[model samples]
Target: PEQAEVREIPAYIIRLQDEDIVAYSRVCPKGCRYLNYIPEPRKCSHCNTQRGRDLCCCGFAVDNPVLKCPKCWSIFDLARKGQILCGRAPRPPVEFKLDLDGESIVIASLQERIW
Candidate 1:
């Protein structure tokens, strides 16, 4: 589905092609650092030889969007909801159930979270 991002909410929002919207928490479970929505990892010349866990091949696989932890280098798949798509580090940013009301998206409930 085509991805259209809407930042009206404080969280990461992805507007689907089907007119449905989904949101995810932006807190990193590893170190409680704020997570950012990265559409794709920037592949630079030096990223290939980087020794620290900053960037890697899995970071390149993020085609749509993924939540990335700046501290522990953890990555969470938006589609998988708190599950580590590549690296294992999720304080378990949960999926909040939303209720759409015209132009507003309301938080209906929160998904059960786990570390």
Candidate 2:
């Protein structure tokens, strides 16, 4: 999914593999750079293991990429607890719980802390 905003904050709404829907702050805490939604066959997942076709640094040529950290080469796999896979970030992504309205997802409150 592309970057969308919640209450003007950069965020993304992701539908997990299990069909569960959730939201996360797309802003990287390391430098506040927007995280790229890079799918698998990724360039890399961390600093030491380079397994994918391209390095996580390459922001080009990726189709449906997972959330990747361009500044510190960190990658986030949505299937997990949305942890900071690598790099210098001290915490995981901030999660925002969504509510199901009449055929819509709604954000009804403001959260100032990281989940």
Q: 36, model 2: CA deviation in Å?
A: 0.7
What number of clashing residue pairs does each candidate have, in the order they appear?
1, 7
- For each candidate, the alpha-carbon lDDT, in order, equals 0.62, 0.60
**28 in model 1: Cα distance from truth in Å?**
1.1
Give every collision pair in model 1: 29-91
Instruction: Extract clashing residue pairs from model 2.
Output: 37-65, 38-65, 38-66, 39-64, 39-65, 39-66, 43-54
Over 54-112, each residue of candidate 2 has an lDDT whose tens digit, in order, gives 45443333333357666776655566656555567766566677787776777655345
Q: Give lDDT tens digits, candidate 1, residues 40-60.
A: 555423266656335553435
Candidate with maximal lDDT: 1
C-alpha TM-scores of all predictions:
0.66, 0.64
TM-score of candidate 1 to 2 decimals: 0.66
